[model samples]
Each structure stands twice: as structure tokens, then as C-alpha cells.
Target: MDKNEFLTVDEIIELTGFKKQSCQCEALTANGFSYAKDAEGRPKLTWTHVNAVLNGQINVVAYENERPNFGAI
Candidate 1:
């Protein structure tokens, strides 16, 4: 596996500061982040996804267990 290929669950957790995959998944979904699942059916955020979030290329409205407030949208 390439070192720059994909971001693991732990890496994503640390990067996004979420405790679990479900929480991270919800955040990613809210922010329109596209990721893939591992062989064990776990979500793996790719480098692109991380970069987009970190670099502000994408809208990350939530972190650390705070869900996006879609306020009647």
C-alpha cells in the first residue's frame, strides 16, 4: 500500500477529532466528502478527501461530535 494512498480510520479520527467511524461518516456526509470502505467494511478517507477538508477546498461545518445544523433545509 502506498503511504500517500489512503487515510486509515485512526488517522481520520485524529484528523477530524471524532471518536468513532459513524460520527466521522456523518460529518463527511454532511460536508460532501467522498470516501471508500476498507476490506472489513470500514470507511477510509483518501488523501484527496483529507486535503480538501484541511485546505478548505471543501466545506467542513462540523467536527468533534458537533453535527451540522441543517436547520430545516
Candidate 2:
């Protein structure tokens, strides 16, 4: 857990408990996203991607609140 190191996909998944294909990882590699993969393919997602995903900047649709039906109102 040093500043020079990062977690792998499984680690991130375990830390965040985010399901597979969630934006926690996808947000890392996304264009214009806070972080990207290093040459070794490890993401700085812990700092950048996790927050964005939590804040709805990425992978938002999956966590949406269910729309309420008003009975044709």
C-alpha cells in the first residue's frame, strides 16, 4: 500500500465490492476521466475512478433509482 503502487482489478473489486464490468475500473481507462492505466496497465483508479463512479460520472445507469409509477398520472 505504498504511494508508488496500485491495486489490480481483483483487488479493486474486493476493496470496493463493485461487481464485474462496473465503472470503478472502466472509469479509469475512460477518456477525459480522472485517471488512466500506466504502461504496466495498472490503473490509478483508486484515486480517480472510484470517486467518479460513486458520484455518477461513470457507470451511472446501473445504480439508478427506480422510477415511480403514478398510475397514469
Candidate 3:
């Protein structure tokens, strides 16, 4: 990834299909996600963080129906 490319809280929300309270913002609050400040001191997340959450490393699945769509793997 390029240094200019980074994920925002909103983008991570869309990619992970998680509610703001349950994802990035919460991660930031709980210190579960990786992030840094922008020039304005706003939080910034990375694709790596999104992927980790999506892959269940952080175990954010709140509902059984929302578990990963894994097939026969």
C-alpha cells in the first residue's frame, strides 16, 4: 500500500459492514485496532486493521448470523 492510501473510519465501516459503535470507533476506544492521527489529529485506520477485524482476529461478530461467510474452509 502507498503511504497516501489509508482507511478512514467510514470506509472501514463499509468494508466490514459493522456498526460504528461496534467497529473502528469502538476499536479505537478499546485499543483493539491500529490507527494514527491525521494532520488534524483525527484517527486513521489501515487496511490491515480492517482485514484483521474481517477475519475475526478481534472477534467482533455480535450475532451468530453475522459470522464469517466461510464455506468449506
Candidate 4:
């Protein structure tokens, strides 16, 4: 897999073993992988994110972005 390339739909299907987009998305989400739908509604994920999730490392920026900061409290 190229560093700059997003995982192709075939790759996603091979990984998740689902031919349907919805199932693929759910599988990816359930596994803590972050992805966006392409113009064709296929899940698109980066190799970096996949490796991070597989290696037990969360994407820090994404994790931080999902929480509310209460610094002023």
C-alpha cells in the first residue's frame, strides 16, 4: 500500500469481508478506524490510520477533536 494512497474498495472488502458499503463502514467504525465516504459512497481510509488502530495507537488529533475542552472551568 502506498503511503499517499487511500485503501481501495477492493482492499476494504478484503479486509472487512463485506461487499456492501454499509457493512464495510460499520466494520471499520466498529474497529475504531476513521474513514470518509468517497463520491461513490465507498469507505476511504488511510494506511496510517489503519496501522494506528491495529497497533493500538489512537490518532491523537482526532481523539482530541472528538472531546470538549473544559479548560475554562
TM-score of each: 0.55, 0.29, 0.43, 0.72
Q: After superposition, how far is residue 16 of candidate 3 from its true place, in Å?
A: 10
So what's the TM-score on candidate 3?
Answer: 0.43
Candidate 1 on 1-73: residue-level lDDT in tens?
Answer: 5766787667878765786777877776666676777786567877876687768886555442465457857
- Residue pairs with colliding backbones in model 1 are none
State the lDDT of candidate 2 residue by residue for 1-73, as single tens digits. 5563555667666654565544555643333334555775454555555557667776544433343457768
Please give the lDDT score for candidate 3: 0.60
lDDT-wise, the better of 1 and 3 is 1
Clash pairs, candidate 3, are none
Q: Which candidate leads in TM-score? A: 4
User: lDDT value for candidate 1?
Assistant: 0.69
Residues 23-50 of candidate 4 have per-residue lDDT tens digits of: 9999887777779898999999988888
Please report, in order, the local distance difference test score of every candidate based on alpha carbons.
Answer: 0.69, 0.53, 0.60, 0.83
Cα displacement (Å) at residue 9, model 3: 6.0
Q: For residue 62, give model 4's deviation from the true position in Å.
A: 11
Model 3 residue runs over 4 Å out of place are 3-5, 12-27, 58-73
- Candidate 1's TM-score reads 0.55
lDDT of 3 by residue, 1-73 (tens): 7765787556756644565444545556454455676675556777777577667776643533465668947
Candidate 4: where are CA atoms >4 Å away? Answer: 1-4, 59-73
